[model samples]
Target: MMSISPHQVISAFDEVPTVGHCLVACITITSVLYGLYQWLLPNPVPGIAFNLEATKSLFGDAPGMIKEVSVTGEFRVWCAKQVKKMDSPICQVFIRPFSKPWILLADFRESKDVLMRRKEFDKSSFLSDGMECMGSFHGIYPTGDKFKWNRQLIQDLMTTSFLNNHVGPAVYSKGLDVMKLFEMKMNLAKGRPFSVKKDFEYASLDVMIEFAFGKNWVHTATGPQVELLSKLGASEVKFDALDQPVSFPIAPIMDFLESVYEAPEIVEKTINAIMPKLQTWWWSKQSWYKKIFDEKERIMKEQVAIAVNNYRSGHVKTGIEHMLMREGARAEKEGREPDFGSEVFRDEMFGDIVGGHHTTSGAMMWLAKYLTDWPQIQSKLRLVLYETLSTAKEENRLFTFEEIRRAKLPYLDAVIEEMLRINAVTVTREALCDTTILGCPIKKGTQIFFVSNGPGFLSPSIPTDDSKRSETSRAAKLNDKWDETHDLTLFDPERWLVRKNNGEGLLEDDVDFDGAAGPQLAFGLGPRACWGRRLAHMETKTLIAMLVWNFRLLETPPALSSHAGFEGIARVPQQCYLRLSKI
Candidate 1:
């Protein structure tokens, strides 16, 4: 039904009218029906409704709100501002009549209820079917049982235990590489402003190579002198020393991953989703893509070959090794032959790697900015690190994964939480069946967005249900409850620290994951939440600690301050600049 074009629908409607009088009568009836729909159809969760035609119109047609949403992660910040003013915790937003009405929820409890309960909400096919992406594309678009099997297979690699051994040292080593590179760049610039954007991007990709492969693959630039598989989309990797070079075919593999992540829009998605074979046939004809896919296949073969060799040898700790072993286990369990060397296996391993690598690295940009804008918090953080990691500092060594995890640094914890809150994406889910949230009916097929950043993250305190209290006093109470000492919008980690024992610090446990959107949700909620979250936190925490202990982020560079970042699936800060003398 969806595959049928609008022109065909219009033509069918024209055929409904037999003659001139009949055509006039049919037009009147259609107009009346549309008017009735406008009048009825439950008032969409009320706030400042969008004037799509006036603001979004080109020559004059609603270009849709998704263009903005798809292009920038910052749109959620704007959404955060709008939904906060609505009367209820959940609001409804419709971009166009053809599109599903977006159920926007500010209440974290409701978000959890929907996200956690798979019976009620399954991940909408928008990312896959809506985008016309082929198949459930492994680490890309998730669907059905294949997703479950793949997720289960890769689950161990992303776990806190596995990553603690694998990721911590790799991230620390890469983080140091970045620090040294930045120090050199600062020295060369003298007093001029220098950017840390390249450092973040390259360090992230570099870290991934070690984390994913576990064995030597490609060793590109570590400082300013070398090119990071330059033909690949990555910016540049700088070299601190001229040394070892690891050879690996990196470009085609990374190119495919990049292309998959950045899928086409609604129209193309619809056509491609409905007619995948034809779509595939057409896409394969493109010479550029043919080369890309061929290269991708070659890279996958190389990866498998290396992973198999590593397994045969004693060096079997890599993510690829974990995946390959799991595939073997599954074959024994299911009474079928082991299936390796397939696209499915490739997607699961590479997809998880890319997801963990890019998102985790992207998060550093936001954390850096927050630290730069709030130097006092940075100072306090350094104190905590020095006290907690004093042994490591004196020993001239990196803190172990356990030490980083178990350290009594609530301020650092709070700072990390606060950064995640202000910059996290509001997750979306589609109703698999008819569901009701907080008494509001969510029809089956409805697409809902859990606005985690609004009341849950930034608000700090949500409204108390007391109909007797006036809105003004309630507003005052919210201000008093959530933000008594500072502007909630500013980068303030102090807000997360509350009195515990004799000192102030983060709540006793992972407070962010609270159903109400305190610190818990940047990764997501429930069983289906991000498997890589713990590893992400550990890696970022290690990097942040290393950077803070070594240097102070003095002031935000003008370019950085205005940086809205790469407004996409993840809102990555494009640049982070600081003028510093090594401590």
Candidate 2:
């Protein structure tokens, strides 16, 4: 009514906005700011950023074959060199582009600390994923209450008695078979240059199959199991990027021929394949096939059915059966439904075969290599074996567990310890929570790593006249005077032996045999340690003793240096080329 001018109208429009319009604008601004804050402050610490440009800068122009990949994305270095130079254990930080915060422990003490606390931390996502893929047949990848209960059940199965009575026999019989194969092959070649790894694999597979299935597939020299085992072992070492997040793709391929036609996929695949007919016989009696649909549950049912039938019929006498019958009976008496799943028994058997066979075989191959490389040590070992075997009866001819226990062969013990120290079998456990480790603040979900040695391995801090010299100076001197003059690089078992005759040595010096006894992180520590440790030790020692007792192993000359060798993972010998002759 007051005849508003155009200038006045424009001023009013600019001064104020509708309440709805203002609210919408404010909401948009808040969202953008919140998104920026999230981008800046992520919860889980982001792992090492993958910089393709940085990677290329470090290793792109490097010459020759790239031997190993470094944790820092650097390449073109040998594994040994990486082990010496890299700060992280196993030469890998395990920090993928999106992986959570990880602290890799290269120092042995730090590794011990982490391993000692198994209850607080669990297996990393990667290992769990791997077990899930490979162990779907037996429900190995359980979670929550099921996982806890199942793990307890499996632990009971791995008792000392079961290993000594059941698993030990299987290992011993297989070891003898391996010795026979070695003798046969050496005879055929007339002590020619041959890869020992292949033979070891055959032996290991034969043993594992027999233990799992209750029969030896390789007894008939021309069996599919032999070939399949070889293929499986070979494939096991190669890392498949595709299987990183999930392991399903590789499971079916383990039995490709059988799986190709989809011929009634029954019985747990992977470790339980060898005992398929036995498992199927048990499964036929179960009515739960119509009720259970979950893959793991179904497979667990089959394994449990086998275990239950065996227990009831008294067919299976040892291993998981013995443990289950004892524990299950106790639980039932206490008015508690054991709640012990079939998966528990299955995992115990599966874990024994998977964990035992390969590791023992690998160790034997490495020991053989060490003996061949250092003939003096081999001579000493043979002398000891001869001495031990000479005084034994026919019944005691084989190196039994009791004999190894009573035998105070320091040199042999030292050699085995040294080999294990130098080449650890596996890097186990990872952090699942944010925690401080060795004063270092590790974030949640970090891949905590452990190794066999620390700064002591590379830099001698032990107070000796040699310690006065700086590591750089010692390294330079080593380079200048590096020859076959008892170089540490040269495998020397005598370094472990105490030379009492050397009058130059002081009597009360603190000799640090740091890793000799105590707890070995190799088989793990505390309750979660390897269940088949004794069986593995017996198998490895027996095989090695048999070989050293019956045959002389010598390294091939340079003319035949180029030969197929063993490939390793974690801490395994890649290959061993040696000439074997009957003693």
Candidate 3:
């Protein structure tokens, strides 16, 4: 079913000889037959078949995903609707025309089963291969022995102690820098709507860079736009949804990394089949890819050089450095050579930066937008923050590290959980071998996406079987902490609150988020979940508190909200032009 028509047609035109013409005709006709065969092939898996027509693209679903998904943030909501409408917790959807349909599991129980059965379903090499195309292979997208090996070092570096003593303090320090920049923007605004996004980005990147390389690069990397966001746009735009187009600078790198999300057929098989030769050809001369790739590797090598020099001088300050040291020691003890120079190790650090940088920022941005959008929820959260971090009131400033670290704030915890659920981060996996997920014949090498939003939404409603009961009452009975509002479409932090049945909406303790499987797949499920999730939570809550304490962020035009489209490997918040008033 692979394409061969163009080459054969070319070959036929090149010669008029009888033998050559006949061969070309045969090849061209055979290619047509093969393509038709693939086109007419039936679904290989046994399940209810559904396809998002918009998700169809030249590269299969990838383009549709970019247009309707990464840009608009509609994928999760649509999936949740489909699961509810069909009444099937698990279903199948074609990734592209003529590609094997991948399974989509919406029910928590089945999804958890699929997640736990790692022997049959594990991380795919589709992204691993794409990373190689960029410059090097990454441990972020791998399975089996390689994942375990990389994981050991990652675990040591992201341990609780490292986060508390190092990463936490570092984030707080950078967050203060962000607060200062926000002050500049506020002064320039004179009570107007402006984007703190650039400052937000710098702060997140600043923390991550220091965490990864023991250095701060935000001040140097920040653009003039940071100081001018307020004056560039009018204050009127913040009162309502601004419907104008806003340019995103991060599009290119996001597009480059986007191959990781391509359909199983296109990326998993086709890219692997075609890219290596093309890569070899393009890399030889002054091609666009060659120049970009060179620049990328150049940056990585430069950082690696600095990090190594610092380590030798007893100046290691980043988690990466600690990870490498632990890994090196372990390798020495095992009498095996450590691989600091390997492409895998180098890319692992790159992966951390790429993975951590915008994602945390994007999540924080969304949390901010939601806080603005959901004013009632904001009031509740503010109350919780004030009561929990009461030490802050002494000076009426940002919460200290110790105050922020004080035991869990139920509303705050619930808000973070709900934000992640609504803005679900997707994880893609391929069947490690021929296997069945929930009795469906999952073909080998089929890339399946495990989405958190669908299950996270559904789990809160699943345990209660009485549909006759009010949705709110049923959902509350199942897990009262945050089910006060049953409208899943809206942002409700109270959904994570414990419900006490006393003829009134009463919230008690915080839900056990760490162990909660159904709704709390923010870091994903089972062993292959996100390694940096704890740090993600810590930084997000800390940054959120910093923002909330310093100012009262009012609503933006819907056009410049978290729901706005900003396309990339992941969906990001765009044009968040909130009205910021100093508290």
Candidate 4:
């Protein structure tokens, strides 16, 4: 009700500073209010469980995670631990500051539902962002026309005929080289426990390189080891202690094999960045990155030229040749020339090499540890191999690809399944649109982490009723629950094997491996599952049969045999040592 005169207002305005000062003051106030609002705001999704402190800060869970990662050097396991910390099957964490919180779902039924039913979910932007460091045409891109095209291009490589005829034989032949390398190492170490992790990794890389480029492309990683050890005697290899790991001459960074191994590590680092695509751009500008990138490009160009020449000569033995053929077919269908040097072709081949090597190596590394720890299981597997491959055993020869593939070794299959389940890899997906999971609403573009090493997998599942799941999920339910009689945390292969009545009624104790008896997301699920699963199974089974048949994996010292593992693109054992004796 009080009226102010113009003179009084002028006097008050004169007390204030310049316009710039007033503007600065306004900005400061606005910023403070915005900060407060962000800090006080609740999680973006209502009714979903999250860390309480995250909702009270602008950065959310990122600071805590950065701290944890700095100390532990692990990201995937820490993500899984959040589910246990919250004591809920579904929980959210804000990893990317200012972006939407990531939902961590540990329940297999719901996670499977989301992955299997692709309408509500698709490959995460996180994947495409990570793969951006590689190229836009990499197969990990989100579900779309691009993904379909990339998949179709390499579809022939994964076919049953190609796998059995081409991949199986190549894997078996390379695995023999690995087994021989281990034998030479065992001799040099003089019964000492030594690291075989690199050997396994390199051997896998060799197989992948061959798989990608065909037998004519000579770039085996284990070739250097074979060359080195074939010349050196036991005393010539200089090592101090009998208990220590033997060191082989290091391969240079520019070496094609080593470069292939190191490139994926950079991709892993890039994806872990706050802004993955931006990080990739920054990395691309750096000299070190450029050097590797250039070297890989050079090699790929050479390989592509060789593959083209080979195809012209009617040589169709390699994956690249088959891909070129597929491209020709597609081009004919579309009424266009096949682009042999296309980014899509190059990216797919490189992506396959990177993806195939890391995952298979990780699995093989874990297999060595498990075999060393449980000799009984090892012995049982050996017995089965010997029984199933009796002709090879009687002839005292290595098992053939056909022999191993045709053999119905239930126990061996169980071991592989159990290992995959226990050490299942982490997978990511993004919501395609606004959707609900386990009765909780999920916003579009929300990144969801489906943990394979968490509840309903490595531990007892958090109880939930079927009524809470989506009607589609409930109707599509096919998997049975894990047998509650056994401890979930234990690594027992028998969990996958169940006695079944033979239709002929001749064998009452016949057992079959039931993959659906329990939860497993090792290869993920549905349309976007691991593309190389069949190849992985074939390679793993053959390698295991060969290794167990060739040598008795002796137990290692506790210090050398620690089960502690560090998670990267794959969860690899901190220590993978083998003490072997010839069978």
Best by TM-score: 4
Clashing pairs in 4: none
Estimate candidate 2's RMSD in Å: 12.2
lDDT string for model 4 (401-476, tens) is: 8888988887888888988888776788999889788889899999999987777888788887678888877888
lDDT by residue (tens digit), candidate 1, 394-470: 88776765777677666676777777766677676777787566656678888677776676566644553444233
Better of 3 and 4 by TM-score: 4
**Model 4 C-alpha lDDT versus the unseen true structure:** 0.82
Provide the RMSD of all predictions against the true structure, rounded to 1 decimal. 9.7, 12.2, 9.3, 4.4
Q: Which stretch of 10 consecutive residues in model 1 shows the poorest summed lDDT?
A: 239-248
Clashes of 1: 14
Instruction: Point out where model 1 deviates above 4 Å.
Output: 1-73, 81-86, 130-144, 221-294, 312-315, 395-406, 460-486, 501-519, 563-565
Cα deviation at 188, candidate 4, in Å, is 0.7
Off by over 4 Å in 2: 1-67, 70-94, 117-120, 136-148, 156-160, 209-307, 314-316, 334-341, 393-406, 425-428, 458-490, 494-520, 558-570
Report, for every candidate in turn, its global Cα lDDT versus the true structure. 0.60, 0.49, 0.60, 0.82
Per-residue CA lDDT of candidate 2, range 245-336, in tens? 11111212223122211111232131112233444455445654323223333443555566566777876654445546765776888898
Off by over 4 Å in 3: 1-44, 51-87, 133-141, 216-293, 313-315, 336-339, 454-485, 499-518, 565-569
Point out the higher-scoring one by TM-score: 1 or 4. Answer: 4
* Backbone clashes in model 4: 0
- Highest lDDT: give the candidate number: 4
TM accuracy, model 3: 0.75
The global Cα lDDT (0 to 1) of model 3 is: 0.60
**TM-score of each candidate structure, all chains considered together:** 0.75, 0.62, 0.75, 0.92
